[model samples]
Target: MEALEKSREHVIGLFRVVVGLLFACHGAATLFGVLGGPQGAKPDVAAWPGWWAAVVQLLGGALVLCGLATRAAALLCSGSMAYAYFVEHQPEALFPLQNGGEAAAMFCWSFLLIAALGPGRWTLPSLARLRRRPGTRPITRTSSTSSL
Candidate 1:
């Protein structure tokens, strides 16, 4: 049962990391125009909403990825996606299919889930262990020299 619980936590953590990575990629594409954007031309840093959203995505995604302030970062990311869906896509049509807002909707929900559930037990191993008693040593197996 404990193993199963740990497995579930690891899976959730992996999901969070992957989502953060994808979100960060979107920011990189828009901010740096590296992955694919406007033929390699970066978005204007002074732009109103687009630039601001990208900055949030980049920074928030990183925090989520590292499991640091995961809840707050996920909340911000979720809000940004919600804003994108409503402001940029909702006016086009009633459904996401017609509005071309599938990604936004998905990201919004994903980040919301992360915010609610948290980083889980699989948060970066070293950092997680740092919370343990200062003088405590991690347990490890050792080979027996004498016959059992």
Candidate 2:
């Protein structure tokens, strides 16, 4: 229990990175037809919900991955996934098991969790702060001190 508690933040950070990476990959695949190509024909540029949804997924995922504006980005991602589930999948079936909405539901819940928990220690902003802290010098190849 003590070990788990101590590593909670690290676990959350790993979760956030993975979720963000997967979300970004999903968006990229949909938008660019890469990574085994889009589910169907790629949506036309500026197309309705499809294009917009992909945009949100890519941008929001990137933001969350970098832990920049994580709360807002995670919230947006969660909302988008919820919308995808309810509007796109729920209409076909009452539950995710039969609706092919498991991914949507999972992503929605995962992002919601991230939004509530916040970004953990590993983040771009945190790294920048560490670098800029007093008495800390920016690392360089020629620098004698390797610590930091």
Q: How close is candidate 1 to the true structure, as a TM-score?
A: 0.79
lDDT assessment of candidate 2: 0.93
After superposing candidate 1, which stretches have Cα over 4 Å from the reference? 1-6, 38-42, 125-148
Model 1 over residues 43-72: C-alpha lDDT tens digits? Answer: 588687888888888888888888888999
Q: Model 2, range 4-99, lDDT digits (tens) per residue?
A: 999999999999999999999889999988898777778999998999999998899999999999999999999999999999999999999999
| Model 2 residue 50 lDDT score | 94
Q: Any runs in candidate 2 off by more than 4 Å, and if so which?
A: 136-148
Query: What's the CA RMSD of model 2 in angstroms?
Result: 6.5
- Residue 39, candidate 2: alpha-carbon lDDT: 79
